[model samples]
Target: MDIPSGDTARKRISESTIHRLSRYFRTLSLLEKENFETVSSKELAKREKLTPAQVRKDLSFFGSFGTRGLGYPVAELKAKVSRILGIDRIWRVALVGVGNIGSAMVSYKEFIKQGFHIVKLFDNDQRKIGSNHKGIIVSDIKNLRTELQDDRIEMVIVAVPATVAQYIVDDIVKAEVKAILNFAPINLKVPSGVHVRNENMVMELEYLSFAMVNHHSPKGGGKA
Candidate 1:
């Protein structure tokens, strides 16, 4: 297959392929920790429970990184995948609503490990406003847009109730914050240029329930 290079490949990348890239990065990290110098497509596919062709196809979307006998350099490939996923640099983020899920997101160590720093926090509750967690003082939701702009937040996590999610997102849009991770059950209406991803735990659980009841095997069952 012709391995396309340059920015053109980015425009044609699929969300599933991006997700697989994350999985590849994770496996590569594990392999590096295990002192594996290089990994072949078959080995990567075996670890990820995928086919070698699938693995090669995913990497081919970006560019050729593997050699016939040498395979792929673990650390170098991991770094390349990180850059591809745009997680190589730190992203300034703000979390709106200091409720249950919001607080959990703040405590997640993986966020910082993945270069997503929550430098600012916001909540409408007077009790939470001005409270400190992990060295960040929670700002009042009233000042969300202004604070977000001032702090130069690249992304936001909205954990407020569904009723107010749209309202909060409207201001985030105004602040020119392009990316959002929403926990509210309701789907948010965003402008064409804005990007929003929903984290609905209940929906995921529903999918699990469906799969269990249906004995659903995922589409690809082949391993390497």
Candidate 2:
């Protein structure tokens, strides 16, 4: 089931709507395991603590997933959502830096289960280089560009220090790898067409702290 690459639908999809689809996918997976054949919008909404209308609207943007009375087929909907999210097939990934956060990401079981396979590791420290973590050997940062290009990496997760992050990113860009998940605290400068997702733990924690003090809950099913 390949999703269309239509410009109109792609432009209309908000980050919020895509996020809810992920939630809906997870809910559908649980329903399948529970022996559910079909699920109504109202039922899915209740489980995810969202309004039925929002659920319907989100799913409608992609296409009809439910029948008039029978509702959406659980297993089928899950498969569709996975394809839409581009997690239906394996993505070869590389991780730069063997620090605490980087190591944790490699050990995360969900990454592999969800089709993100981190097959390369890079670090500047000579001691860390050549070391193996969970069967993937760490390569020297000097060989970062060549190794990434040779391995045909599709995405790179950066967990390096703030000072040298840009230098590392420059090499990645030169290699023509466009997707980056950066854990460095500083913002990275990348040219247009490059996708960079920053993972700032402190900023997220601050948001949670503010929410707690203000007695505020995230609206539009945006809670983490």
Instruction: Residues 11-72, candidate 1: write the lDDT tens digits.
Output: 46777788899999989989999999999999999999888998999998778988888899
Where model 1 places Cα greater than 4 Å from the true spot, the runs are 1-11, 221-224
Predicted candidate 2 versus true structure: per-residue lDDT over 37-139, tens digit per residue: 9999889989988888998889887789889878889999999999888888999999999999999999999899888999999998899998989999999
C-alpha lDDT (0 to 100) for residue 163 of candidate 1:
94
Go through the candidates in order and give the C-alpha RMSD of each one to the true structure.
3.1, 3.0
Please list the C-alpha lDDT of all candidates, in the order they appear: 0.91, 0.90
The collision pairs in model 2 are none
- Cα-lDDT of candidate 2: 0.90
Question: Where does candidate 2 have its weakest 10-residue lDDT segment?
Answer: 1-10
